[model samples]
Target: MSDEQIDLLFHAAVELQQRGMWEQALTQQREAEGLLRGQPSGARRDERLAALLYGTGGSLNALGRHAESAGVLEESLARYTELGAAPTLIADVRMRRAVALAATGRGASAVIEADAAVRTHLDVGRPSDLARVLQLNADVLADHGDPDLAVASADRCLRILLQPGRPGAADARYLFLAARRASDLHAAAGRPDPALAAAEIAWTSGREQGFAMPSDGLRMVVRLRESGDLRTADRFLKELRGLVPDADPASYPTPEPSVTLAQAMAATGATGVPALDPRDAEAPFVPSQRSAAPFLATAHATALSAVCLSALPEDVPHGVRLGLEAHYLFAYASEAQDSDLRYRFVTHGALWARVLLALTLALRPGDPALADDLTGWARAVVARLPPTTAEAVEIIAAWIPFLDAQDA
Candidate 1:
């Protein structure tokens, strides 16, 4: 086969990966790998083959096939070294491989690989590449090595990315993610002040860049509350409420169930909704009436019921995990206007309310203050529902007891 065939497949795989179609992306990547494997041995073939392996490894990692990903990435690393690939390219592979290794329970080796990758990038001195590697290294160290060491690495990465007027400074999204990670690490290490500072950075940058969500504001609120700064937390909580939509059903004409779900997702900036079985990784990327919505909401009236149930005690813990993960996807994909207060007040409000409900499930249980914060925001979601929507009414009825239990 021609090299163009391989290139097309690789590009398609990357596009699918970016669209969050990990299973499809892995399939495309493996198809390309097969084509490359069949090619004759030569420098050009070897280079393409190595890159193909790298892409395949990435798709594997995204699909949670960590051991397979590590093996594929290791071969890619060897091939790239033999081809004398650029330091930046090799370092990128090493960082990804390190993550795969860590996921497969080789935390010590993961730290070593990530640390080596960071050093390689430092030697090359590309501001963006070095900063990226350093951030990954910090995460690896935090998970496997010392928290203090991880904080130092995270701080160094922040310094490079936050440098004013530095050529090739990281993008807004990267800066936001790194700051959030730093905040979590600091909070975990019992450094509340630094945690608040880093959380502030994430919140500020996320807003300025139009990617901020209630979750970002909630992070700051949580940190402030934890630090015994109830006054500040209350103020932030007010601002956070402004980001949520008041899901009043009378605000918009009801559409078909699937269309309502789709529109709600669009308003929240969520790309896809999972099927009822979160374990079914092969489900369609988007929800459809014929396929996903019914399976998820059969017990309740509205499609939004799945989101609420997933967070409640009736659902399995794993379902709650999946729901929260989807919630974050919505959070990060959100633009300032997409999730703005009262945007299409009906569906948008319902979606945001359910998202907050899911969050209440994820928060450290037994914190009455935090639980109150979440429940209050979510209750406002269903407070305006029309009596005709029996399904939503049923879910809200159950939700009251859950909220009462929180206070109890």
Candidate 2:
């Protein structure tokens, strides 16, 4: 109950949180809060309370209690606003609150909060702050269905971050985010060059920052495919698979089978060029084999697979076709989860591969029914995909007719 005891508890809570013991951390945080509440009111009371609320809210968010986390963040935001803290502090609280709101399905409210945070950062007139604001704005714009604006915001952020003397971690993060937005925008605009360039920048920056998300690698492969660099894309896919293994069959949120199917197809066209061993690369983050849940593991694996498949040769072998079919069956047999659905729908890596394969078969100068099968699969998957995934799927689907015409 003493001040010393409270400090000790707070430090312990932080350590626990860092160790991935969310529940224990939350318990310790709550204990610390209770100790603080029992003390008399004073000048530092509000500050102490704000810290406690912020920590509690952050822990709750990590534990997937979005609604509760939002409540705590809302309280923290109110207190930070009353204190008239520096723009940086206020912006941080607002950003956290916006994330919580988004997690709870309050998309419109989240965007408003994020926009306000961006405005506050801009008002502060710091290049770093401005870069952060632009990145946040990019995310909000992407959510709002304005890919062009999102890409522009990210580009602006990246320009600032790339300037000399900026913080390395912050610059890397902004550049990575910008690359992602640019890639998506280029793909949507049907421009392969810009997308490939953006993807390469993002992948290189992310690797340098020790951030090895599956999405980063997948984006690179996708852009390479779009640019007709199948050989490089295929090599990249093999490296990704080695980084993240396939998920177990009994996991709750399994990835779509289509991803593995696509990878199998792509591998067939690999030039067998010896790639630089990832272990030898001076990457900031070395990819590890931590046993994360089925959802994350599967989704990451699928993303890599999808990109690989998308980069396959036009005339793939029958053996590869058989392997793809088997992988597809495996994906289907896996339990359907949100991660799987999102990967399938939003990334559309699998759909792209299937469509490409169908197109290849149909336009073979003597083949038929390729369009029908592709259309049928696209329709079925499109109906089940979320809005984020819908746009990518639609774009790939639109290419089907052109492929058919080529055959005719």
Candidate 3:
């Protein structure tokens, strides 16, 4: 209940924190706060209470109680402000709060907090600390679909980390992280060359600097290769294997191609479409697990038509139409990383959907109205896909809108 006892509890909490006993430390800090607040409230009380709140907030963030961490950190900031806390201390708490906010999916707010930290660190001339806020800003921007700024901020972080005469392990680690994130952002933005370059930097820096990376990042090289440079894939794979000798290539995820209509029908134990002859029913569509982000969806639409048109069976009544629709479906089924990629996929897939619908009408010349059913089938097929995001669900719903009252 006394001041000495409160001080002892706070010191014990700090000790627990030093030992990585965050939960216990949280409890100790909370008790210290209760003791401090039990006395008559004053400037000292506010300062002491703010310190307790700061410790509790940090522990909560470490425990991944992000929303609660943000709330407590905000309270700490308000108290600190009331007590006229130093700029460095305020910036430190704000930086932690920004991380908690980002973890809790408040990207816009997280950006603001991170920017504040960056400004503070800049004024204090702590380039290493500022690099953290820079990376955090980049990540939040990327999640918010601002890939350009994300890439830029990542580049800035890397520049800052590499400025020191002899960059230490932490500097190298941050540089690697920034490069990796920059590569992904570039890829998402459909800049393959830059993406490959960033991936190369990330992988090479991580290895040469002994950064103790959580992963060798081999998959990124594969992605770079798959996006445009097939040659790089082999080289990166070999380099990654050498860099991480303990890693198992077999353990890497095998990309699963999208299920074709024939495969889906077989899986569902459904018969072939009644319109097509039994002998010519097996579709020629070969769906792959690919998204348009690394490329344009419109390009896939055009390419799929050019590639599969000749292979389609014109001998059967609706063979060409079925094959074309199946081709587009295969291309559209690729899982996108985010809404932009999904939107592009759907946009391209819809173009083929319309063309196939027209062909269906021509095939059934007697029943021109049957075009609606064909379009409906395409929409339904696309809708059957497991939507991963709200935007993805919207894209599915609008998949064949022109066939009905809906628009692309």
Clashes of each: 0, 4, 2
> With candidate 1 superimposed using the best TM-score fit, by how many Å does residue 268's alpha carbon deviate from the native?
52
Stretches of candidate 1 exceeding 4 Å from the true structure: 166-170, 208-215, 226-228, 244-408
Count backbone overlaps in model 3: 2
The residue pairs found clashing in candidate 1 are none
lDDT of each residue in 170-214, candidate 3, tens digit only: 577677778888776656555667666777778778779765353
Score every model by TM-score: 0.57, 0.54, 0.52
Report lDDT per candidate: 0.62, 0.58, 0.59
**TM-score, model 1 to reference:** 0.57
Best by TM-score: 1
For model 3, state the Cα shift of residue 388 in Å.
45
Alpha-carbon deviation at 166 in model 2, angstroms: 4.2
Order the candidate numbers by lDDT, best to worst. 1, 3, 2
Model 1: per-residue lDDT, tens digit, 298-319? 2122333354454355543433
Rank candidates, TM-score, best first. 1, 2, 3
Query: Which 10 consecutive positions of candidate 1 have the poorest summed lDDT?
Result: 283-292
lDDT of 2 at 323: 25
For residue 328, what is the lDDT in candidate 2? 34
